[model samples]
Target: MSSSSQGEVVYTPQREARSAFPMAAILLVLGVGVLLPMALARGLTTNSELKVVALELCLLGTLAVLLQPFWGLVLVVGLLYVRPEESIAALAGMRFTLLVSLVALASVLAHLFLSREKLVRTPFNVMLLGFAATAILSTVPNWNMAEAVLEISKLVILVLLVLNLVRTPQRYRAFVTTLLVFTAYLALYSIYLYFTGGAMQQGELARSQATGIFSDPNDLAATVAAGLALALVRARNARGLMRLVYLLLAGSQVWAVVLTYSRSGLLSLLLVICGFLICSMRRKAISTVLAVGLGILLFVVAPSRMTDFDRSEASANQRFWLWSDGLQQLYGRPLTGIGYGQFPEINGGWTAHNSFVLCFTELGLPGYFFWMGCLYYCFKRRVPKATPEEESEEEKRDLVGARLALSGFLFSGFWLSRTYVPVLYLLMCLPVAAQIAARGRPGPQQVKGAEWLRDCGRIGLISLGSILLIQLMTDFLK
Candidate 1:
């Protein structure tokens, strides 16, 4: 293969194969799979018995720390979907997510230490570091220092792992594929829940809500919307059966989002559809027509009970109240604001329910700025200048999908406080990886704008626009 070929693109590999790591991980998984059921069958009822099993499991997981950081990424994604404690009452106090996260973290750390490689730097690294620093500083005023620290630490670790591991385009593609598959599984499972009467019921109306990682209907909807955006991109690029497969995935995800009956999710889905149309349709007329058609389809299919634009609904009013209180806090402490995770503590047990508001109120002005800055970079960063012949079909799809994914997240985030989720950080990594990969392609020239002021201006305009939209919504509700 030529050096310029897509197959030849260089990606950093894990440092060493201790040969024992995968064996250890396999043995640990198999041991737990085999022994846990046996223990349960034996009616192990004593606390000591449970403790012994738990200790053995933890020790095995620790021993499974492997040289392959990619495996850690895979493990973390799988772990995100399952909450053992929630699904099993006996393990209610196990803190399974923490345990899985630790194991994944250890694997990545082991790989990095063996490789002696520096962390991959991107344009937003400094911005992210600033945000993390501010968040830590704000923790001093947090309602619960331990909880805040724990939450922030998890976010930091996840962000670092993504930044360091997903360096090349191939890795980014694999990461997104895994994300799409997991999201699809969640969508299918949620539909099953709805059919089985596991969904929320208000009289005869049923609205599907997932469990474990996406327990909240809105969260489930958000993930589905994002995944649908990716599937749309893939469908546009695919041919034959693969195209049909992607379309099926997209359809299923759309169905799951509608089943959630979350207005924000619906709005986000519409925006994502618009993005998809824009990317897939070259002619403006075709794009506009398809978007309108999609809107009509949604109007006809969505359940009126949830889709009836009722501004006076209790949930709608509650969000407004939360925003009002969040704004008040933001104004009162405009510089430093309340500490991390303190909004619910102070606002009568109400969360901000708005990502922008949550950011400003939690980490104050600097946090808000850095957060906006990060988004600006993600959406607006420059890619290597590729000629028509140089840009591959897959590259074009990746670029479009990442942008649409960002759009979906932001649209949904307007009504949900998910600023710190691992998925969000992983999405942010996409464009960075794309840019790096583009630069590595043969015969590519780097175009330089290097205008920080212009970028800052754009970020400011976007932030203001978001605030104006929120204000308009508030006034309309009034």
Candidate 2:
């Protein structure tokens, strides 16, 4: 298949011959035919029946993935974000996430090999691989090698799946829409939890929490902040009813973040809003007015604790101490620090509570460069410029939304140790995915030799500056 200059894929005869099969339908029929009688049988125990149902579902899901890998990508994403195991006791013992992700990875490999499709390359690929390598290398003497390996594997699979599956504009939109829907659900559910007194209490504050990775109120707020940014961008680019839907989602996410009462969450939300306004090309006056109004609403509705930055605040003081300890560890081993996943163990059962510090402390300068480089390139637009008529509005919206989401996450990460989170990898990959969907291939230019050195230097300087700033803040707080 060849791609047009306009990014429309043109399939050759061989590629056209490889059209989607009816395997999913056949699998569905077979599963129902076999499981229906088993489920109806009165001789089966409850445990046996549940196991049977789970088996049938897994069979169907695996078949679907083998036939259409994009569905598998979506399913894996859903599993990661929604985490049914946490909510459903039955699923807790099933190892469903690991099984589905393995199947998805296999499917992606088979599809790429069979279809002769080139792996879509991005500017961040090298840095990401370097970061993964560093993780593996740093694991040699780490106390938690197994956990570190698992986290690195997940990150790699997440990156590969996004790069390979989201190859078209239609798929990109579908993927993003799926994320927005999931985010809306999580946000609304958190809101529900708050009102129903199901919220979790941190100290004296009752904070809203969602299932899965969002169980932490701060993480929930940060995720919602990213979703809100994307929703705002989509709403700006959308028309009619779809615009209304996105706007409502954005508003709900905003309120949900406030309900979390996370100080970092509030900062992330503000950054997202500011990003939207800055990236926005039209209706500046009206957008500014709406943004101001939103800010006021957030302030009015936000819990008083959300704005508290007292020097004596327990959490804030703990973070400062953690940062200080993390820096000390990095100093002890500048080139190769402790090891990945060793921070909590070495620091009296406390994490760095800062992503940057986590990277420098755990994996050292090399790892820190790779990790920050991935984020650095995320903000850099790699797609070649197109004429106004040739530019896809949807593509533009997707790119803007990806950067805004990353901004929110990164700002929040300054106060959270999320270095290995799948959400971070997903956010980093979205821009590259969008670019590939728009351009139909990797850009011609690759950063190499001198340019690569320059970028490395810049990342190093940034890392140094961040460390110094943290040190200053810690000292001032003391």
Candidate 3:
């Protein structure tokens, strides 16, 4: 084929015939080589034989990891959703964690020595390293040092991988696209569960809680809420059929979140919807009407078991007690509290059920500062503000969506203990990555030390304020 016009391809008869010949040869080879083997060689059919085949496939995957380390990062992303340990507990069990660890090791090593380019030491990079240090040091006083170190280390590795590897807008977009596609599967599955009433029952509600990485309906809802945020932003930027597809995806995710029966999930979705109304769509009248209708419908349709605020329900009483225990722990040990992941042991075998409470009680003051500082940096740092004409719409939408998603997460944290969740950290890293990519090269714009310190101070005040607010709520409940 040749170009008849500057940007157009002209297919000639000779070129078409040549392509047909290659296609014919490929089909002939596939028919003879593939079908002949299947017809003559009867493939292994027993359980033992399948195990052997799985082992061989794993070996081939190992070879692929060795050949292309970046692909290892992509695999890790997929595994985060598939969560083989939970999704295929009967077969893979915790072996998936081992696989991810190996892949992480390879990817980091390859990035360090094999790749010519090095990760830029931006402010975000420093903040992440500081957060990692804080997590490690907090473990020094941990109730279970080994467990804290292992879990926190895994989280840190995932965060660092995103911060270091995703260095361009294209790479950032690719990750978002991959994430959205994976979450689309979750959205569809949740919708299916809603229709089929396949969700697990908890208390008086039939909740669409997921197993594996997300343990409860609230966590599942948070995941969907985050995806909904991203979809809203992308749909705003998309055109024609693509826009319609994203809008549909967003709608499905909203329905899934609603099916979870999690107040936190519903709140997260509301935050994103409000964000859409205010930031981009500006459908104020529609938003107002929808908000009012949703409020009435929730009260009318939701179970009295959940809606009762008189502390008559089991979950309400449980959360109140958990929050009380966690707050008491924070007050008792303000500097270094009960230690990371120790709330369950101290709080009647239940999580703090509040992210800020979990941080304050578990990590104590230092860890709280570090953790909140990371979030504050993301929230406070201005997206590299060039003129609207200068900024790419993709970058603009990404930053907006990330902030909205973070808002949803923080809002959900009032009821969900997701302090160490990888999804939250991943969302935090996105704006940092997008800003760096938009700048196109290393520059002074990448550095912001003083602002980080300010965020730490602000977060400290916020932590104290949160404690007082909880105290007032506790007193009121009493």
Candidate 4:
């Protein structure tokens, strides 16, 4: 054959290979995709269970590789072809924390284009902008631009996930229960630690900390406090043994929180409890107040078990100094507010631990308001505004999830609170947004399922992108 003729003739083997392997490849891809989230979601039972689960997933994932190996190959291509510069949204894994943020930003831009006005008016958005600003400016001075970008991205992914997964009550309940169960386990572990672990009686402010499953006692206490608060909200809708289990979980967590000797956690727990009581049925409010008063009196009338308040004298001062430094930076760069996470770039002055302060320093007044405003909007008087006949199932679920999510958002005071755990946060909040989205929109059975799938695709891309990002920025996280 002539050279031109030979070149024009397609390779039969390559064509056949593509045709033969498509389904297998798709299958393999699906298997790995499913396995990743499942492993991430239910991968850990206990420390021991974690290993077993990993092995199980590995075996299963391998089977998928054998059966639908092409799918895996396809996924790899999709990942590379889709690349970060192509879209702010990444492909794979359904997660909402990051998606919501991108959407909100788009919404703001859209509003400006259509109505010629600013979309976000709240102060907290300014704070977020500040954080972003700080992170960016820090990038120029420090060679850790990659790390800072990844950190902010992780938090953004978290917010996106919260918006997506929390669309239904069932999912919302599952997420809440998951947190409670994990917290209960930690609470039990903390009890074990209290008995078996060593105590520090004289290391000054940081001495009397409770170390649970985690290395840091403050982290453990903070986690326990958040769990207890979340459990209190969850138990209200439960029944019989379910309620009992949740109450026990809450109690254990409360006990764990007390043992941590973290005054920040104590204050957070107190605020959550007070909020819980206020949200309770009016008739029960009086009794709850009286019981809570007695419980406090018993605990803190004098030197009690939860008296770690006297400690951490330097912690607040340190944070104050950090805030002061951050403020100086913010004063200079008010519009952009330094850069996203630039604080550590200049010197180790510690962070403006308070989210409120961090916002002012990093992104400035505008970004700060937008972030806080979202919270304010959610926490606004959730009066039963809907007529009995008007509210749809999705709407009801969204409202409920929103209330619970608001609780979680507010509980971020004990430590640095951003959307680090994207999946967890999205699972917690998606039900509310979904429920709201569903009220005005309804469909047939097959269609709704398809909608769910599409929703997954949307969130998955963002989440998958986030996971990839996390893997990419291991150095920063470490």
Q: Return the top candidate by lDDT.
A: 2
Encode model 3's per-residue lDDT on 102-183: one tens digit a residue.
Answer: 7655645554554344445555555566666666666675446777677777777776677666666777788788779878
Model 1 Cα lDDT, one tens digit per residue, 1-478: 2233221222344445465466556756776687556655544555566555655564445445443556566656655655456665666776655666667777666565655555555547656777777777887754466776677677667666665677666777777788788888889999999999799876676779777658788888887898888888888878999999999999999999999988888988998998778777779898898898988888788777546767687777888878877777777897787988888888878888888889888887778877877777677644324444555877877877887887787788888998777677767766656655543432322222545566666767887676667667766673
Between prediction 1 and prediction 3, which has the larger TM-score? 1
For model 4, what is the alpha-carbon lDDT of residue 129?
Answer: 52
Better of 1 and 2 by lDDT: 2
- Model 2, 1-478: lDDT tens digits are 2323322121111251253355445655665687556554632565566666766667678777877888888888787778888877766767777788888888777666665655655557788999998888887875567877777988888898887788778888888887888888889999999999889987787899998678899999988899888899889888999999888889899889988989999989988997698668587878788778877776676678887779788888889998898888888888887888888888878899999899999998889888888887777653334344444776787788988898898899999999998888888888777766765533333666776687788878877887889889978884
- Arranged by TM-score with the best first, the candidates are 2, 1, 3, 4
lDDT of 4 by residue, 41-136 (tens): 554653555354544544454444344332222222222222222223222233222333444334333323443322212222333454455555
Q: For every model shown, what is its TM-score relative to the native structure?
A: 0.83, 0.88, 0.81, 0.58
Q: lDDT-based ranking, best first?
A: 2, 1, 3, 4
Better of 1 and 4 by lDDT: 1
**TM-score for model 2?**
0.88
Q: After superposing candidate 3 on the true structure, give the runs of residues whose Cα lies further than 4 Å from its correct spot.
A: 1-58, 141-143, 194-197, 282-312, 383-389, 443-453
Report the C-alpha displacement of residue 335, candidate 4, in angstroms. Answer: 1.4
Of the candidates shown, which would achieve the greatest TM-score relative to the real structure? Answer: 2
Off by over 4 Å in 2: 1-48, 281-297, 382-389, 442-445
Per-candidate Cα lDDT values, in order, are 0.72, 0.79, 0.68, 0.46
Candidate 1, RMSD to the unseen true structure: 5.1
lDDT of 3: 0.68
